[model samples]
Target chain A: MNSKSKIIPWHSRFDLQGITFLFFLLLCLGSFPALEGSGRDLDYWNNLKGFALKLFPPDFSILRSTLQGIWETIQIASLSTLLASVFSLFLSLGAARTISPLWVVSITRMLLNIIRTIPSLLWAILAVVLVGSNPLAGIIALTFYSTGYLAKFFSEAFESADLKAQHALRGLGADQFQAFQYGLWPNLRPIIWSHCLWMFEYNVRSASIIGYVGAGGIGLHLKLYAESADSWNKFSLVLLCMLIIVTVLDLTGERVRKSIRDRLEGKSSLIKKGD
Target chain B: MRVKNLGICVEGKWLIRNLNFTVRQGEFLAVRGSSGSGKTTLLRVLSGSITPDEGTIEKENLNSNECAMIFQDLQLADGATAITNALSGCLGRNSFLSSFLGFTAQEKKQAIKLLNLLGLSDKLNQWTSTLSRGERQRLAIVRSLFSRPRILLADEPTSSLDEKWAKVSLELIKKDVEGRNGSVICSLHDSHQARDFSNRELFIDSNSPENWSIQDVESKKS
Candidate 1:
């Protein structure tokens, strides 16, 4: 066995790729039946068009209030993401296999897995219950949700990093902290910044919806506008604001990514040496 | 440092066995063997990164962490500047808080001097990722020398350099370590280099671990 030789089935009548595609196609068809009882499928488009007609000339009357709501949503997203990033970094230092003992890694991973298993909406609902439905509830909820995801991301990244430099540092008499700082942190910085930025972007979108659970974001306004028939146009304005913010956040992330790339490539930037 | 009956078994194969040797102060010991002859493994053991399956190592006048290594792979930090890679050697000496304040002026000066000696004066602020293979190899050497260790373990340290640079670098290392009364145990494939720089040669037979032996370079030549 030279190892490079590719192994192929000697003789097989089975069309694996074809059958896999067919299975997914049939699965999609089978799942469509679940939507059968809704009965409004034919009228759904007509209802949307009618509702869309009410959204034109979005109510400028509530623009000021909606802007405030959006600001509050942005605040929730930013705070939660920052808090989650810091907390997750701490968690991952214990969870990463290279850093901690087996028991600590197992316990930390299990805790993150448990948190991740819970739905973000459920977390928001729980936060509302515990903290009395304030913006703080949204902060608490998103922090937990993002922490679960970020910990797993960071720990896996840490594990996948080449350990050669780390071993050399350790052999040269560096403590574990120094090894991480000088050896691993240089390579891990971009990945960490990218994850944090992504988390922040996702939180911005999520913050708007958590208010449905009374966790305090623009979703509370969305819920209020939906219930009051006369304010349908205002709902359109709120959605528009969210869309604008999401786009802006995406553009900002792109800029940050470019700068991080520039820094990594050693083009310029006197932001201190060492990665 | 001394070793007795040193053996390392990997996956039930004896990579090295019945090895007995001493690296006396100020000695330049060159280890020569074929590829996969356990040269790197032996240096790793000396550097304390690998535990020997069977051996007793004796050390004197040096702490466990006082050994520095120049790895064959260079093992430089990809995102860090060349200067930073050199300064990282001092991590064992400085307080943890000093990392926040950056390396001291004296430390920076020391690293710059080493970097310059290794022909990396212009690459001090260059990212390690951007350096050529030879440059990176030199940077690794500078890093190993930065610590002023009592023991220097280098594995194929000149593998990436041209013949001239290789001999020049080896000469510098030999001169410096011997001046400090430090011992150097370096793995090499080039027999001429081993003969030129080392006082003694340790040979490992990859085909038969039982044939491992140490000899004076002059005796072998004679």
Candidate 2:
């Protein structure tokens, strides 16, 4: 048969070129103000250098108080993370589409979205207004923020799990809870542990900043030192302590996450051998 | 057990309609059908996994907990050991807390015995994912038997087995049924196997007005 169709050019075959053009256009428009603001005089750099010189040989007289503040921050973060994990575990069952009914899943997800829409800083501010300047406020704020974040993550993990085992267990007359315990829990345990650890690490970072709202941590001290302008060395010391705490947390989190991943890999490799 | 005018509709389309059948104690019923003809649906309805849109099933002396199904996909927990998968069959009959605590010593002994009987003694503690297709099918049979069900519903139980393993699997199921004075309803594609292995046969067709028909194949065997 003779062909009557005309060939189309490569550029016309897909919208990739058009999409890339639009992306670059948007990037240029978005960066215009930032590019304009970035042009600064040499005086600005000299002032920054002066400020940097003042931060060295930090004041060691407030070391004990700084350590205490660090301990309070750790307490706020760990306690909030633990409470949030429990809250998220309860909510995820209702939020996961695979297990919950349509209305329950939709309602729970909507509530979680609303909770997550508000930033942790906003929650910290609100809690400080309601509960006064205390570690309790910081713990409450972080707990609320983490519950929303962890619920979304936990529900997604539960939803992606295979449902065949659950169906088989149900067919055998096991109730829904029993089926979840026997069929779904084994598949989800490792992921749940990983997500909780991730949330704990995140809370540690948030807890440090939440204290800026007078929630009782190193951030309050940092704010005080920075506001005074003469205590730049103490501020530097607090910053250093914050960096050290975050680094230690990140390392510990990485080690725990890696161990979990290794165990999961080992179990999966055993399963793969059967395949 | 008797099913009267049973009908099942999936996603607003009638899959099986107005079906009637009876399975006597110690009898094996073979259901024969082509692909997508709702053979699995019928077995699922009998096992009470899905509610029929019409009609009722009357199973005397059999609660839902007393029924076991051997799924065609061999729905074994891949992360668990063979013994754990087998032990799950007992979950229906045991108390919830007890089952969560895991199998009792006597239950474990019985599970091991059943596994040994199915030529899976060597793979007792192995992960189910590592089992061969035939081994997994045999393991499913072993799991089903561990429940000591009064009504066993097997969906294409031998579809993945060799002729030798298929026959052995069928024999094991038959022996379990006879020992418990229970009944079995199995779906199979092979007519020869259906005629040879079962005492009665039921044919289902999606296009047929009657939906299903039955024959006394055992009388022909005699």
lDDT of each: 0.87, 0.84
lDDT (10s digit) by residue, model 2, range B54-140: 999998877777888999888877656778778887788888888877778898889888888778878877766667888888888
Across A110-148, the per-residue lDDT of candidate 2 in tens digits comes to 999999999999999999999999999999999999999
- List candidate 2 segments past 4 Å from native: A1-24, A27-31, A38-40, A43-71, A94-107, A157-161, A217-275, B3-21, B50-56, B76-84, B100-103, B116-139, B161-168, B189-197, B201-222
Q: What residue pairs are clashing in model 2?
A: A274-B130
Q: What share of the true interface contacts does candidate 2 keep?
A: 0.29
Worst 10 residues of 1 chain A by lDDT: A266-275
DockQ of 2: 0.25
The estimated TM-scores of all candidates read 0.85, 0.77
